[model samples]
Structures are given as C-alpha cells and as structure tokens.
Target chain A: MIQKILNEFSVNFHFYMKLLAEHIGIIAVSISIAVVVGLWIGILISKKPKLANYIISVVNIVYTIPSIALLGFLISLTGIGNTTAIIALTIYGLLPIVRSTYVGITTIDPSIIEASQAMGSKELQILYKIKLPLAFPVIFSSIRNMVIMTVALAGIASFVGAGGLGVAIYRGITTNNEMLILVGSIIIALLALVLDGILGIFEKLVLSHKLKKIGYKRFTAVIVAVIVGLTTILVTQKSSKDTIEIASKPTSESYILAEIAGELIMNETDLDVNITHGIGGGTANIHPAIEKGEFDIYPEYTGTSWQIVLKKDENYTNDKFETLNKAYEESYGLTWRGLLGFNNTYSLGIRKELADQYNIETFSDLAQFANQFTFGAEYDFFEREDGYKALMDAYKLNFKKVRDMDNGLKYQALFDGKLDVMTVFTTDGQLSDSRIKILRDDKEFYPKYIAGFVIRKDIIKKYPELEEVFKKLENSISEMDMAEMNYRVEIGKESPRDVAISFLKDKGLWRDKDE
Target chain B: MNKIIEYDSITKSYNGKVILEDFSLDIMEGDFLCIVGTSGSGKTTLMKMINGLIVPEKGNIFIGGRNIKDENLISLRRKIGYAIQGNSLFPHMTVFENISYVPKLEGKKEEELSEIVNETMKLVGLPDDIKEKYPSQLSGGQQQRVGIARAYANNPKILLMDEPFGAVDSITRFHLQEDLRSIHEKTKCTIIFITHDIYEAFKMGIHILVMNNGKIEQYGRKEEVFKYPKTDFVKNLIAMAKLS
Candidate 1:
C-alpha cells in the first residue's frame, strides 16, 4: 500500500515540485516580510526604551496563541491561501526577530555609541555603520530561527488553502495512507534543516571580521540570489497559463467531485483549471474567496448554506435547496449550480471492534453508552453548526472526551484505537477501511446536505456559454458513484485527476481530442 | 596662548540631584589638563561639555571661541576627539576603519583616508600591520593605541580622554602614558584627561584641577597645586595618594 502511494508522488513529480516551491515560497516571503517589519518595529520601540517592554509583552501574547486558533481568527480579513497564511505566519515570526533586533541594538557598548557620536556620525549613520553592523550576527541568527519555525508552521497554513506539502500530508492521512505522509513530512523536516544550515554559515561570517574583509558575505548572497532566481522563474512559469481557481474543503469526496468538475471543464474548454483542495473552515473560507473572485468554482454542500450560513439549525426536508440558493444569491452574490445528487452529511462511526462487542448499529443505541467511549472529530465538525455542539445537544449524549483531530487524521486515529468514535462524512472513502463501522443516525440531527457546484455569479455572466456547458454535470453523479470515485482516489491511491478523467470517460462526458 | 575651550557658569542636574553648579573654566590652546575628582564630582561631564556630549542646564561651553549650543553639535564634536573607558575601539571595525571613520564622515577620498589612517597609527606608536586587525583580535594596549590613532586621524584641536587606560594592566597603562606624552608633544593639541589615580594625574597633566563635591578645590600648574593646598579636601586627597 505504501509503495502504491510512493508511486503516485513519482508519477506527478513536476506538479508536486511546483506545490513544494509554492509552500516554501510562502514561508520565505512571510519570513522576509517579518524580518523587515519586525526590525523596523524593534528599532522604533527600542528608541523609547520605556515602550520596549510593553511592545514585547504584546508580541509575547500574540506568539502564545495556538497556530490553529490564530489561523481561524485571521481567515476573515485575509481569506484562505497565501494571504491568510503569510499574515498569520508573519505574526508568528515577529517575536524572535523583533526581540533579537531590540536586544542586539540596545546591548551595544555605550562607549562605542559615544565614540560614533563624537566622530560626527548622524543618528542614521550610527545605526547603519555602527549599530546595525554590530548587531548583524544576533539579528541574522534570530532570522534563521524564524525561518525554521515558519517552515514548520507553513504546513498548517496549507489547511487554509495556502497549498504546501502539508496539503499532501493531510490528503495522505485522510486517505489513511502512511507512505504519503512520511514522504511529505521527511521533505519538510529536511528543508528546515538545509535552510538553517546555510544561515548558520552566514552567521559565522558576520562574526569574523577578517573573513568579512575579503567579501565572505558574498557566499550567502549567492545562495539567496539562486533561490530567488529559481523561485521567480518557476513561479512565473507556473502562473504563465491563465488558470481558473477551484477550491474544496479537506475531504476525499469534495476533492473527487471537484476534480471531476475541473476535469470536465478543462477537457471541454481551453482554460487551465487550478484546484485548491482540502481548504480549512469549509465554506467559511471558500465563500469569501468566491465573493472576492479568488476562486472561480468549488463543490459545496447545500445544508452548509442553510444551517451554517443562514444560521437555521432545524432540518427542513423540503425547500432546503431553494433557501440555500436564495441565500447564496442575496448574501454572497454567488450562484449554486445543479446538484451532483448526493447528501454527504456528518455521521457518527465507531471502530469495528466496539461495534461487534456491543452490537451497536444506530445513534440511539450508542447514546446510552456514549460516556464509555472517547470521541474524535475534525476542526469544523466541532466548530461549525450542525457539528459536535448541536449534534450532542440533539442526541442528549456526552462522550468521555471529544478530541479535535484534523479531518485527515480522524479515520486513522479511530482505526488505531486512539478514539472509540469519530465523525465521518456519509460518502467518506475510508468507510470501506474494514476497521471502521458506520452507525445509523436514528434521530436525524443533521439536515439534508445535497452537494453541488458553487460558482461565482460573475463567472457565468461573463462566460454565458460556459454556464450551459456546466449544466451538463447536473445529476451526472450519484452518491454511490461519488463514493466509488473517492474510494479509488483515497483507498486505491490513484490520482484525483485520473479518477476524475476515468469517471468522465465512463459517463461519455469527455473524450481526448487525439483519441 | 588663545583659549581653545571655556566653560561658562554651567549648571547640570539629573533626577533632582545636582551634578554641577556654576562651573566655569578656561582651557589654553595646548595645555595638558588632567582632572582628579571623587566619584560623581562631574569631571566627566565637564570634559563631555566641550564636545556637546553633555549639554548643561543653565550655561554655555565655548570651543574655539564659538558657543557649543549655537554651533551644530556634530560639527563641534568633529573638531574635538573623544575616547572613553574599555570600549575605545568599535569592535566590528578594523583598526584601519576605526581610525578612518571620522575622516570618512568628512568625505575624504579613499587614498586620503588610508594616508591619514597610516600616519595616525604611526603617531600613536601602533604597528603599521595592526591596522587590519579587529578590536577583538588586539591586546588591550593595542586597542588603546588604535583608539588614540582614531582620535588623531581627524586632526582635532582638542583631545578628551576619560579613564582610557582604566581597563588596561599597569604595565600597559604606563606605556600608553608614555605614548600619549610623546603624541601630545608632536601634535601640540590641548588634552583634557580624567583619571581616578593621583599618580596617573600627576604623570599626565601639566596643569591639574583638584575637585571635591562638584567644586574645584584647586586649579593651577601641578607644582603650584602641590606646593599650596587650597582646601582640606585637596590636602587630605594628596596625603592619602602619597601614603598609597
């Protein structure tokens, strides 16, 4: 199984390299901006030594915020992807860079400062020639530390659609594929090590006055120049094609359905489609991007609009689609396209061992013994409405503890017996993993959540012909068809694009021009 | 001789503590004036006032017949060289860079800067090749000569030294004093030095200002101040120095 997963990476080496560059680029950009801004702030604060402590206190508080919680808070202003990720990571990188800068400058010998002043050095001159040059080693070491930290955190940023190796790792875990996670993690760890090593050499050069006289700093400059040159070439080359952005929440079914739609669109049209998958905060992230026109399309569920968007918790059997479509039009200025004929609602599941031991097959039956088992769930399953809070209240049950596992790791955690129960999507491919058993929702706490395309309203208006072409996808996929597609990509370790293309070919919706 | 520095009734205080009150003095063009004072007697403040490193609360300091408050402070400092305590050299710079720093700010050409650096190093009795060494690589005596060379590079009208030999060993400080005496004779620049040691003061100064509680007890040529003790503070300080 691991070999099959490794084969997937080798087959798509070019595409994965682009993704890796995108990840590291986000981290590099964030660290660069943080160093510049943090230094500026540190200098300003250090000037009024009285204010330095207070400013550092504030930065300390900001640094203490959990990364996931911080990302959730920043999602609204910056939205998903690189903007939000860079902003959050930059905030996280600030403390060390700023502290180093402040301490480095402040600790300079007063006699040195006096000598510089007595030599007729202006304030700016003293800073550039004496203070900053003296502070270079300290400042550079702190920046190296910030870079290593930002690289690790960049993975978490992938959850918000920032796109990194973390995305691949999450996809791996959600699919319960061990090898893919191993491949992604090892690469990320190694990237941090290599970068720190290079910067370490640079720091030593700064401290050695004799080596510096002969232009030893040029060694560090050369490395920077090469990385920047390659990143610029690759990034420019990657974005050279006019691409349409499609986004999806972190789930197998969402990825498969979105991939199918993307494939169908790309096959019929000349447009290059860029799919940003496994987005955190679900529609909370996607709707704003769609409104701002960052994403052209993504597959979204209807019940999310009714319950989460419209804030109506009660499940209405009929008119769910109408109310959701109207809310999208009025509230978000987006359009909900024809359904794919699936309602992938949240459902409870247990390990097969527990299920067989108690003969538990329904939600009501589990409620009696809920306290005997620990619950695990994805972030949104515990955060959003129609999620853990509402579900538990509706069922009038409580588990021993509800762990907020990442959506990708929930299934794996359950199978490993780390959790007795976990929340799963109705069409989750991992449902066939043998170790997991589904529990029927006897109380029906969740609303009808029919899945379909959510497109920017302006998109259809601009490309009117494309709207009709898109309508062809209406009811083209059933729940079982989607589950099968997800199973192929998630469990079979096939690429989402391959699964999507084969599905389109089987349905006679697409044909290669050469074929 | 024309006066190169004059302090006019300077009053300075910090945090409600009076450091100097109505302090005034005139320094001749080429007098080697060493100030001896108890701790916190404001001798350092008086030296700093000549270059506007410390601005007085209620009076003006005139350097080369110009009021320091009216003159641009940086320009005033460029004409008055300063070295203080253990960190006389900029640690990150080479001895050459440290010596040439003031001249570079004056926008001297590269050749001119190097010429001035070499000449000043020689004047301070530092080895020619030591110009390329960082302060950290140099011995304490070598760093002190580099600091003196840096001061001489500007060809300033006055030199201010505050405890410049305090961190060096006695052997090095004695050598540095000999170097200073020779450099002083060659340049003929007015020097104002502060030292806690009575021996250092007597050896370095042509004229001495004996101070206690921010007040000058005696200001005259070393022999005259030694021959006539004006106050009990000066008599006791000199007797104590002789015994030590």
Candidate 2:
C-alpha cells in the first residue's frame, strides 16, 4: 500500500506541487490579512475595553460557523474560487488572533504600565515599547495555531472550485479511491506540522534576548518574502487570460467528462485549458460560476439543468433537450453541447443475490418486496424534487427503513448487506461491480439525465473550433464506455486525463495528429 | 532650604469617603523626608500629587514654585522620579534599556543614553556587566536596584519612593537604604520616601512626617519629632522605632 502511494505521489508530483503552491498562496494571503486586521481590532478593543466583549463575541460567533457552511454561504456573494476560499479562511483565522492579542495586552502587569507612565512614556510609546513585547509570546502562539489550522482547513478550498490538495481528497472520496484520500490527508497533516515547526523556531528567535534585534530583521524579511511570493503567484495566475476553465462535479464520471472536454479543447484550439474537478454542489455552484465567467464549461446533466438550474417543476426526458438548451442559452448565456451518448439516470440497485431471490428486475417488481428490505441513497436524493419522495409515490413502494448515506459510502453499505437496495446512477463506476444488479426503470419514473457539456456562449464565440471538437463527442460514448472509464479512474486508479485521452483516442476523436 | 513642593488645603475623596481633607505640607529642597503612615493614611496619594499623578478636588499643589495644573503633566513627571513597591521592572527589557527608558523618551542620543545608564547603574551599586540582562534573569534585590536606577536615571530634582524596597529581604533592604542615603547625599535631590517601617524613616530621613487617617500627626526634623511628640500617633510610632 505504501509503495503504491509512493508511486502515486511520484506520478502526480507536478500536480501536487501546483496544488501545494496554490494552498500556500491562499494561506499566506489570508493569514497576512487576518494578522493585520486582527491586531488592529485587538489593540482597539484593548484601548476601549467596553467594546472588547462585543467585538470578541462577534468573532466567536463567526468562528463557531462550520467552515464548509461558511464557504457555501460566501459563494453566493463572492462567487466561487480562491476569492471565496480566502475570505472564508480569513474569517476563520481571525478569532484566535484577535482573542490572543486582546488577552495578551489586557493581562499585562498593571504595575509595569504604571512604571512606564511614571517614567514619562506616552500611551503609544508604552504600548509599542513595553506592552506589545510582553504580550508577543502569547500572541505568537495563537498565530501559530491559526497557521496550522489554516493549513488543514485549506483542504476544503477545493470544494468551492479553488485549487488545493483538497481537490485530490475530494476526488478520492468521490471515486472511492482510498490511495488518493490517504495521500492528500497525509500531505495536509505534514504541511501543518512543518509550518508549526517553522513558527516555533521563529518564536524562539524573536523572544530570545541576545538574538532579538537580528531575529526581528529576519522575521520582517520572511514576511516580506512571503508577501512577494504570493503576489507573484497571484499575478501570474491572472496573466493567463486566453484560457478555458472547465469544472466538474464531485464524481468520477464528471471528472472524466471534464478531462475529455479539456483534452479536446487543448488539442484542437489555440488556447490553454484549466479544469477544476469536484466542485462542491455540482450544478448548483457551477451554473452560477459559469454565468459569472469564473468557469467556461462544465459537464452537467439534462435533468439537473432543467429542474435544478432552470427551476422547472416537471421531470425532463430526452424530448426536452431543445427547451433545456434554449433556456440555458437565452437566460444564462450557456449552451449545452456534446451529448455523451449515455443516460446516467437514477435507478434502483440491489445486490445480485437479493434481486434473484426476490425475482425483482424493475421498479414495479421491487415494489412488492419493498417493505422487507432497507433502502439507502445519498443525502440529496431525499431532498431533490424528482428524488426519493417522487419515486416512492410513483411506485407506491415503502421500504422497511431508509438510510441517508454519503454518496461514497452507499456502495459499501449495499455490498456489506446493510442496505438491501439503494439509489444508483446508471453509469456510476460502482454499478460496474457484477455483484450489484441495476434494476430496470420499467415505469420511466426518474428524469432522463443525459450527460453533456454546458459551455458559456462567449467561450464558444471566442473559440468556434471548440464547437467542432465537442460535436465529434456527440453520441460517441456509450453507457458502458462511460462506466468503464469511471471504473478505470475510480477502481483502476488511472489518472482522469490519461483515461480521457485514451477514451477519445479509441473513438478517433483525439486530434493528436493535428496537434 | 527653599520649599520645592507645597500642597495647600487638599481635599480628596473616594466613594463619598474622605481620604484626605484639607491636607497641607511643605517639602524643602534637598531634604530626605520620610512619611511614615499606616495603610489608607494617603501617604502615596499625597506624594503622587507632586507629579500630577493624582488630583485633589480642593487643593493646589505647587512643584518647583509653579502650580502643577499649569504644567504639562508629562514634562512635570519627567522632572519628578517615582518608584513604587515590588519594583515593577519591565520584564521584557534589558537592565540597560530599563535604566535609560526615561532618558530615551527625553530624546537623548544613543551615546548619551548609554552614558546615563552606566552612571545610574553605578549610582545604584549595580555592576556594569548586568546591563544586558533582562529583569527575569536577575535576583529580586538586583531587580529592585534596576528599578531605583531607572527612577534616578534622568537625574530628576525630586524623587518619590513608595516602599521601593518593600518586597526584598531585610538584609537587601538595609543595604538598599544605606545606598539610597549615599545617593541622596551625592545628588542632594529632595526625596520623599513613604514607608510603613518607622525605623526606616528614623534611620534614613532628615525630616519626618508622621501621618494618621490622612492628617499630619507631627511634622519636624527627625530628632525633634522623636524627642517632642505632640500626638499619640507620633509617640506610638516613635516608641515602635525605639523597640525595633
């Protein structure tokens, strides 16, 4: 297992380095801003103690908010990407810094203050010359905590389509690839520990009497260097404007489709392509991001675009593709292209043994034995308009128990026999397991989720050749092809880009000869 | 000797209770005056008024023949050295930095500040090598000397000490007292020392002011006050000193 992980690390070394740099950039910028703002507020409250409790209470309340929920809330206002991630991380980084500074300043020996005052030291002089130096050890420890916490929390940045090691972890979980998850987690922990050790050395240098003067100069130099490095990273990132940004939902299939689209665009067009994998809420986040031009294209499902994005009340089938495309182009300036020749629609899945024992091959057949078996699905399945409730009402089926499990854990639940039946997408990589039987939607109760690319109108206008590249992908991938590709990445531990390129090459869609 | 500090009819109260009522006193130039009092007798408060650290509701304090209300308080404090109990030395600063703090605030040049620190340290019987050490690295007696050096560094004309040696052992206290006496003789600065120990007052003071309940029980030369006690409080304090 260790050797496999080491191999994975070596294979994806450049990918990890890029994400690591982005992670450092996010932490550097956010922590620098937090320190300045937190110190100012801390000093302000220390001077006016009447305001201390109220300000600290406000910071404490913000700190109590779960980071993921905070990131989700920030997405509406800031849009998605590093801006939203930085803002959320900065808010999380504030409480410790503010509280520590306030406590450190206020708790200094009163006699020391009195002595300075009596020696003709002015208020500002005493604060700078005496109080801050005395309070530094306390404040530095909290900053150390903030830095370590920020390093770990930065993993969540990938959720909102921001770049970080979290992309690896999120992808790992979505694909049920344990190696990627373990590697991402271990790297994040190591990053935190390394930063903490560095800070410990810095603290010692700054606090030691003989080394104080030189240590301060070195500390300032380190801070300046970090700021410069982060600025360069941010500037260089923004300089690449002739680039296409493709996004994917947190699923192996979405990643594969995005990689395919990215490979095609890069090969055929005179433009660079950046793909952000495993966006947190799928279409819910990616739709707004595309409209804001933060992302240029993403793989979205027809039923999801119609119901979730367009807020249509009815189930969308193959016949409504034109209306869905028209609504997207007219209202959101987004156009759907490249029907990937698959219906990854919702289906009931059961263990093959259970299916045979019950003689159930369709929704209607399962309805008879529903009361005897436990049903499980991802959390959103119960909440979506065309989800669990609609399906149950359509078939008049009521199970003995229903479990709301994570999308990643549902397959394991079914395999363990803890779940007798569960919701599954037709092209889900886990569905390729022979032990699980995909039940027929004989009643056609679920909406048709034909997979395709949704691109911004402006991107299509800029790179007209992209439309031709996407057209070749139209009706090209069969359901088996997509499931097989997903299985390769999810179970076979193949890179999505490699899987995507191979799939496109096999179909003669890859323009490697022209490139 | 000229009167360097005079308080006229000072009235001060806290929480509707009078701490000092109609307090009046004169501190002469170059006098090593010790004020011996029990707690709440307002000895520290009275001494603080000279440097404008305390304000009396119904009194005028004249320092160096000028009404302190007319003087900038920072400038006034710069002219009057003040030290308190427990020798509140700033723990983060080196001994040299602590000693030269006031002079630095006065905008002395780096060389001048160092010279002043060296001179003050020598005056306080501190060795030259301890200058770079922080307060936390020093012994209790050493910290107290640094505090005294800091108070005297700028060479103020008046020094107010409120039990500056209160936290040190008796041996250290005796040595500190003798050193302070010599420092006073060398500088000839007016020093107002407050102490709960009457013997400390008798041994070190040129003049003694016995205070009880914020009123002056007796005020005169130490020998005169000891020989001719006019109040019961004065007699009791003198008797305590004799017993000790």
Candidate 3:
C-alpha cells in the first residue's frame, strides 16, 4: 500500500503541489482574518466585561457547528468554492483566538495593570505595551491550535468545489483507490506539522528579548504583508477570461467524463481548461455552482437534473430531454449537451448467494424477501425527492433494516454481508464482481439517468466551437462501454484520464492534430 | 512649604460600608508623609485619590493648588509616581524598561529616558548589570528595588508608595527603607507612603499621620507624635511599635 502511494505521489507531484498551495492559501487567508477580527472582539469584550459572556457564548455556539454542515449551509449564501470554504473556516477559527485573547488579557496580574496605569500610560498604550506583550504566550498557543485545526478542516472545503488535497481523498474513495486517499491524508498531516513548526519558531522569536528591540508593531506588519502577498498571488493566479472551468462529481465516472471533456476542449481549441474533480455533493452542489458562474461546465445526469435540480415530481423518460433542456435554459441559463448514450440509472444489487437462494431476479420477486434483508444506500438517495421513499412505495417493499452509507462503500458493504441488498448505479464497475448480482428493475420505476454535459449558456456563446466538440460525444457510449471504462479505473487501478483517453482513442473520437 | 496635596471633606464607601467619611488632610511639599493604618483604615484609598486612581463620593482634592477634578488625570499621574506591594514589577519588561516606562510616556527622548532609568536604578542601589534582566529573573528584594526605581524615575514632585517593600525580607526591607530616605532627601519630592508598620512610618517619615477607622488619630512631626499621642489608638499603635 505504501509503495503504491509513493508511486502515485511521484507521478502526481505537480498536482499535489497545486492542491497543497490551495490548502495553504485557504488556511492563511482564513487565519489572518480570524486573528484581526478575533483580537478586536477579544479586546472589546475585555474592556466591557458585561458583554464578554454573551459574545463568547455566541462564538462558542458557532464553533460547535459541524464543519461540513456549516459549509453546506453557507453554500446557499456565499455560493460554493473558496469563498464559502474560507468563510466557514474563519468562523471555526474565531472561537479559539477570541477565547485565548480574552483569557490572556483578563488573566494578567491586576497589580501590573495598576502599575502601568499609575505611570500615566493611556488605555491604548497599556494594552499594546503591557497587556498584549504579557499575553503573547497564551494568544500564540491558541493560534497554533487554530492553524492546525484549519489545516485539517480545509480538507472539507474541496467537498464544496474548492481546490485542495481533499480532491485526492474524495477521488480515491469514489474510485476505490486507497493509495490516493492515504497520499492525500499524509500530505495534509505533514502540512499541519510544518505550519505548526513555523508558528513555534515565531512564538519563540516574538517572546525573546532580542526581537523585542524590533518593536511589536513592525513584526506584526511583516506578518500581515506576507499574508496579503500570498492571498494576492493565489487570487491573481486564477485567470478569468477565455478559460474554461470544468467541475466533476465525487465519482470515478464523473471524473472520467470531465477529463474527457477537458482533454477534447483543450485539444480542439486554444482555450485554457481547468478541471476541479470530486466535488463533494455532486450534482446537488455543482448545479448551483454552474448557475453562479463559478464553474462553466460539469457532467450531470438527466434524472438527477430533472428530479433534484428542477424539483420535478413527474416521472422522467427519454422523450422529456427537450423539456429538461428548455427548463434548464429558461430557469438557470444552463444548456445540456452531448447525451453520452449511457443510462447509469439507479438499480438494486443483492449478494449473489442470497439472490440465488431466494430466486429474486426482479423487484417484484425481491419484495417477498425484503422483510428478511438489510438494505443500504448512499445518504443522498435517502433524501432525494425520487429516492428511497418513492422507490419503497412503488415496490411496496419494507426492509428489516435500512442503512445509509457512502455511495463508494455500499458495494463493499454488500460483499461484506453487512448489507444483503444495496442501491447501485447500473454502470458501477463494482457490479462486474461475481459476488453481487444486479436485480432487474422490472417496474421501471427509476428515471433514465442519461449522462450529459451541462454547460453555462454564456460559455457556449463565448466559445461556439465547444458545441461542435460536445456534439461529437452525443450517443457515443453504450452501457457496456461505460462499465468497461469504470472497471478499468476502479478494479484495474488505472487513472481516470488514461481510461478516458484510451476509450476515446478506441472509439475514433480522439482528434489527432498532428495527423 | 507650599501645600502639595489637600483633600477636603472626602467621603468614600463600598456596599454602604464607609471607608472614609468627611476626611481632610494637607500634605506639604518636600515632606515624607507616612500614613500608617491597619487594613480598611483607608490609607491606600487616600493615597490613591491624590493620583486620581480613586474618586471620592464627595469633596475635592487640590494638587499644587489646582483642583484634580479639573486636571487631566494622565498628566496628573505623570507628575506623581506610584509603587505598590507584591511583585508589581511588570514581569514581561526588563528592569530598565520598567523603570523608564513613565519617562518614555512623558515623551522623553530615548537617551534621556535611559539616563533617568540609570539614575533611578543607582538611587535604589541596583547594579547596572541587571538592567536587562526581567523582573521574574530577579530576587524578591531586587524586584522591589526595581519597582521603587520605576516610581522615582519620572522625577515627579510627589511619590506614592503603598507598602512597596512589604513583600521582602526584614533585612532587604530595612535596606529599601534607608535607600528611599536618602532618595527622598536628595530629590526633596513630597512622598505619601502607606504602611501598616508604625515603626516603618516613624523611621522613614518626617510627618507621621496615624489613621484609625478612616479618620486621622494623630498628625504631627514624627517626634511630636511619638512624644505625645492624641488618641488611644495612636498611643496603642506606638506602644506596639515599641514592643516590636
């Protein structure tokens, strides 16, 4: 496992560097803002003891919110990507800083304050010279904790379409690649340790009498300059015009689709292309991001777009594609293009041994034995409008137990005997395993989830040639072709980009400019 | 001598418990006036009022014939030095920084502040080598001397000491008292020193004011107060001092 991870690391060194830089950028900006705002609040409450309890309690409450939930909530207001990520991280960073600053100042020897004040020092002077310097050790320790916490929490930022090392972990999970997950985790841990060591040095320097001669204000100015410089460089590095931004859900299938689209666009045109992989909530998040112009295009499904994005209650069929496209264009200024010709519709899978013993070949056949089985599905499937409740009511099936698990882990759970029946996408590569049998959806209750590209209308207008490139992919992939691609990536341990390129090359879709 | 500080009919209380009521006093310039009292007798409160650290519920305090209520307290405090008991030296600051703190605030040039710090340290018998040592690095006696040096560094006309040497050993306290006396004689700054030790007051003060229950029991020259006590509390305090 370690060798595989090391091999993966060497191969993707540049990719890891970009992720590391984004992670650091997020942490640096979040912490800098937290320090300024938290110190002000700490000083304010320290001066007014009556407000200290109330303000600290409020910050404490905010701190108690789970990081993922907070990010999800902020997505509505701040949209997705780094803005929402940074805002959530900054909120998390505040409690430690504010509490420490307040505690540090308030816990100072009262006699020292009396001495400084008796010397005719103004309130501000007493705070800057006497109180802050004395409280330096305490405040610095809390900042260290906050920095480390931010480093770990920033991993979740990738879930909302922000760039970070979390892309590796999420991609690894979705593709069932443990090596990628391990590599991403190790890098995050090392980054935290490195930052902590840097802060330790700073703490030592600031507290030492040698650095005292330099003046605290000047020292603070240098730190602020460094943070501002980093943010500027990172922010300006993202070029806005004439560049295509592509997003992918946290699935190997979505990742492969995105890479194919990106490769084709960059090959066919002079446009710069950047793909953000493994967005956390998949279509639920990527749709909003595309609407807000944070992303220009992403691979989405017809069933998901219709039921979840459009909030349609009616059953969706292949004939409804035009209506879905029209609704998307009218409501969200998004256009669906390039129906990938594969329907990765939701289906049920049972352990092969259990299926053979019960002779459950279809949904109606499985309904009789549903009471004896423990069914498992991804968390989103439980909440979607056309998801768990609707499917259960359609089949009139009631399982003895229903377990919510990650989409990536449901197949593993089924094989492990933890789940007798699990929800599976029709084209999931894991279904190729002999231990699991794909049950037929005889009732045809699930909508056809034809994979396609959802592109912003403005982007299509800007790059008219992109439409032609997308048109080449329409009705190009079959169910067997998609499953083969997924199996090569997941079971064969092949890179998604490699699988996509190879598949496109075999299909005669690869544009050879040199030829 | 001109009256340096005059408190007229001052009243202060906490939780309806009277600390000082209808209190009046006059401190002459260049006099080392030691106000001796037990805890709660309001000696610290009275001295703090001269620096405007404490405000009386009623009455006015005049410093150099100017009403302190009308004075900018920051400037007023700059003109009056203060030191207190129990490790009051700023632990984060070096001895020189602690001593020069007031001078720096007074907008003295860096060189002048250093000179003032040096002179004050020398006056308090601190060696020049320990100038950069933090208060926590120093011994208890050394910390006390640094505190006193900081109070005297500003060259103020009035210096307030609230048992500044109370935390030190007897030998160190005796040395601190002697050094302060010589400092007082040389600077001729009016000093209002509060101590619970009557013997300390009598030994260091030229004018001794004995307080009992927030009121002055006796106010006179040290020799006169020792020779003749006007109240039973003053007589008993002197008797205790003599016995100790």
Query: Model 2, A298: alpha-carbon shift in Å?
Result: 1.1
Candidate 3 CAPRI classification by DockQ: high
Q: Which stretches of candidate 1 lie over 4 Å from their true place?
A: A1-9, A214-242, A318-320, A346-426, A430-446, B240-244
Q: Which pairs clash in model 2?
A: none
The regions of model 3 sitting more than 4 angstroms off are A213-218, A348-423, A432-443, A513-515
Q: Model 2, range B60-124, lDDT digits (tens) per residue? A: 99987899899888887887898899958888889988888888899999999999998898899
- What is the fraction of true interface contacts found in candidate 2? 0.76
Compute the lDDT of residue B213 as modeled in candidate 3: 83
Candidate 2 CAPRI level: medium
Better of 2 and 3 by DockQ: 3
lDDT of 1 at A11: 75
The candidate that wins on DockQ is 3
Clashing pairs in 1: A250-A278
Q: Write the per-residue lDDT of candidate 1 for residues A1-515, one digit (tens) a residue.
A: 56764776687677678768877788877887798899999888878888999999999999999999999888877777777888999999999989999999999877788889977899999998988988888888889889999989988887777777888787776555566677777678888999899777767756765456667467658767866875575357446445778888777777777888888877887777888888887877777778888888888887777766678857745466777788788888888886877778778889999999988999988998899999998877766865787888888878988788887778888878899998887787767667888788887776668888888888877767567657888888765577677888777877677888898899998867885
Kindly list the per-residue Cα lDDT of model 2 for residues A5-57, writing each as its tens digit: 89988988898888788888888888998998998889889888879999999
Compared with the true structure, what per-residue lDDT tens digits does model 3 show for residues A207-255?
7776777877899799888888879867976766788999998888998
